[model samples]
Target: MQFLPVVQRIVADRWPWPRSFPRSLSMVRSLVLGVMSLFGSVAVAADWPGFRGTGDSVATGQYPTKWTATEGIAWTVNLPGYGQSAPVIWGGTVYVTAVDGAQREKGFVLALDAKTGKEQWRHALEPTQKAKWSETVSRAAPTPCADADGVYCFFEGGNLLALTHAGKVRWERSLVRDYGEFQGGHGVGSSPAQTADTLFILIDDRGPSYLLAVEKQTGKTRWKTDREARGGWSSPVVATRNGKPEIIASSAGTIIGYAADSGKPLWKLDNVVGNTIPSASVSGDRILFGGGTSRSKDAPPMGAKGNGCLRLIDADGKPGYESVWSAKLGISNYATPLAYQQVAYFVNQVGIVTAHDLQSGQELFAERIDGPCWASMIGAGDYVYFFGKDGTTSVLKAGKEFEQIASNPLWAAKSKPKSAGNESRPGAGSEYGAGETVYGVAAADGAFFVRTGTRLFRIGQ
Candidate 1:
């Protein structure tokens, strides 16, 4: 389809028509042009449109299982600046975001040719709010989501904008300017979630925390629901419950569902202790919530929180949800709880993966992989890929049993790029200095786009 315009132009101007061209043939040409215009670049099934893509559930189509630093690599491209956001794919273009300078003064949105990893266009995003950049703080961590209309990006510095496929800015909004300055120690990591017409953003900070729904086309606030001041970085998930869609947020010890259209509170599940970082995952009528032990000393044990499936029930003329099954063995710390193939998988911060039966919540096996994973595990077909924080990925067979497949490292060694050295350093043995960490990833069109802090890699057959 790269030459689609050329084909259209030729048909319009240079069609080999005789002086007495048949009117029937002219009608045929007009119909062909109309069909092309009708299909004009909508998001197909192959597009990974948003965060954890459709609740981080199992992905269709086979992705690459094994790859080395030098082999099976389609192309590796250096980004303009360091970014923690995952690379999102929409057709032939891959969109990613990054922040530049010591104070994160400038942000970058880049569109790359998906096949060759060539730079298609780069748009420098000027931040509305300024903050001193540091390794401990988030740097473009909120993964941008894509749709057929455009790619929408949100930065921790309070800038959100929509860009077309050809690098045209549709609209931009400053959340801090519209709302207020964020007062969280660490910056925002919650990515944007969207339905057909609205985009949902979770802003959970110590100062002003709220759930906002924006009109996708105009970047205007549709509805805003303010909440108690709580510091959390969990992203919101849009799920259909009781035949209508609801925006679900499991953070700061509560799992609350809000009506997507009206921003009215639907139902709330309390006592989800230490549930801050990982977003909720959806599986049919069941929603899987995960939490780890918080750094606060008084926080309850991780198991005390919502670490299981909840069945949305509509009984006695009331709509509510109840926990169907709870995890007893391990709880998710950074990664969201994964439920695939009737098996539930939980990964702790130290890279230990625990499997449980999706129905009974019985622990199947507990095994360690090459982890300390920050990026969530993506299940493709019969294999689940665990992206480690420090450039290694462990692939495992997806089933009730723990079966190791392959350990793929994105880089042979931890090499610091010039861009990474500019950031201020934290204390020794801190997680801050790991420049090669895999922040997030996206899989689509038979390729896996792995996002490290400073680069993006495409892995394919």
Candidate 2:
């Protein structure tokens, strides 16, 4: 008779039927506990997680601004192979990718002690067929994405892999096989983004380009949408508009927004230049996008043919969207535009930096700073660091006008030109005038991690 009251309470609580009641209840409880554990892990510390630091595209940690090879260097470990991907710092580990000499593709999600740069564990993915079209210096440029659960790395050959924090393989998927061919001359280079339970990637190649969402825990496809435009190399960023998160992506000729859960296209802005390589940066509700001409010949007239423009897309609209204003002056060829406070800065490969008013698409200041920039700009407390191809690093003030702080040189001692096929053939002749040849830069823990030709340097004060 005493048990009757408990049974009644269970019935009133709408518990499942007795046919499988107890077993099902225990399963449900297990799931709930698992989810809680995952949440607890993610809350431990603030990790980089993805390509552009957090989803906001701002690298805001206690990073240092001024340093030399010996000044602020924390620890520099020689990477086993070579990679052009930026190092993704998570919790206490730094994950990066690399390739072997035989072109037998290998990926490494390295866990480095956050403080001392000590090797924690190196998780290697199954070897893949190397991409022939990819430049030797630009092999597998896709950066790793990590959270509390695991770190995800994408290869140029279309392999998506997941590794646990302790160097265990979680799950892996081949994009080229499951999805389709990525048709770019350089192969797939865009990094994947992670939300609550989804891993989103922009697979824009020559074939049918698409934005794919996979279950973060199991590597299962959640939803994949074939993008309307052709594929480019820019990664996608999650934006919050009207209290809702939207995955904002720029492809060949359009910038689009899709629901984070479902793969539905929420809104799109056409007439955008195709082959865009810069990721979208969000400042409040306005999304800033700019790029150069798709065709190589059109490079001469960048903004003239409408190939480059700074577009401000209003993310508050219902099923549609409108551009607040667009200007031709703020277009970037390869580097993504950086927005700090109210000013958005744009820099092209040819070394032109333009400052624009975020509210109004007005060009506040435009000046030619340096030439041939391939690396993305990183803004620390008060300085914007620009690494040029000629091995020169220029430090400038982040303001309306150009203010050069310091110009440092990165000269390699070797002068032999090494062939791509044979590492011993020779070095690249001279490094004094080779520009910076920098690919990516990240700021964290008060030190700047700069990825040069074959080394990762910790530069800062």
Whose TM-score is greatest here? Answer: 1
Q: Mark the regions of model 1 whose C-alpha exceeds 4 Å error after superposition.
A: 1-45, 299-303, 415-434
TM-score, each model?
0.86, 0.79
Evaluated against the true structure, the overall lDDT of model 2 is 0.61
Cα displacement (Å) at residue 45, model 1: 4.1
- Scored by lDDT, model 1 comes in at 0.75
Q: Which residue runs does candidate 2 get wrong by more than 4 Å?
A: 1-46, 127-129, 133-138, 294-317, 410-436
| Candidate with best lDDT | 1
How many angstroms is residue 341 displaced in model 1 relative to the true structure, after the best TM-score fit?
1.1
Count of backbone clashes, every candidate in sequence: 0, 23
Per-residue lDDT over 165-268 for candidate 2, one digit per residue giving the tens place of the 0 to 100 score = 88888888888788666666555667776666777888775677788998878999989998654546778877654334578887566778898779899887
